[model samples]
Target: MGSSRWIRPEIYPLFAATGVAVGICIAQLVRNITGNPEVRVTKENRAAGILENFDEGRKYRENPVRKFVRGRAPEIMPSINDFFSKPDL
Candidate 1:
């Protein structure tokens, strides 16, 4: 029984883990083969994908807090460069 073959008792845990992973993969494959249905985005669910995507297009628009902080300065950041840039005056 002390003779070391291809499979060792010390490596049993690794074998078990590999078996579990293989089983999970096989389960996923079977599920895929059986046609796992996709979920459709609904308007009532407050679908985030489109809005989140389009929101990036609104990055130039000033936010309320930004408007409060910089007032008209936030709107002019991209166009005008030298404003009240004095360090000591």
Candidate 2:
């Protein structure tokens, strides 16, 4: 019991790693079954050429907040930038 207790702590990291690996494998398996299949350029697809007005090719519009920030420069401190940007007279 004493030796087993000592061994358990050392083996805990291995157990955790194995559990994580197993979980990832299970997740991938489930995703493969439920998710869309990978797109491949087959001979038939090549002959078909580019799809016109593809359903998935619709233009993506940003949300209001995202659009507002899109053109603006990222600043951690706008006040600091404003102060530094002014010409020293």
lDDT of each: 0.58, 0.65
Q: For each candidate, give its TM-score against the true structure.
A: 0.36, 0.36
Tell me model 2's lDDT, rounded to 2 decimals.
Answer: 0.65
Candidate 1 Cα outliers beyond 4 Å, as residue runs: 1-3, 37-89
Q: Backbone clashes per model, in order?
A: 0, 0
Worst 10 residues of 2 by lDDT: 54-63
What is candidate 2's CA lDDT for residue 35? Answer: 40
Structure candidate 2, residue pairs in collision: none
lDDT of 2 at 36: 21
Off by over 4 Å in 2: 1-7, 38-89
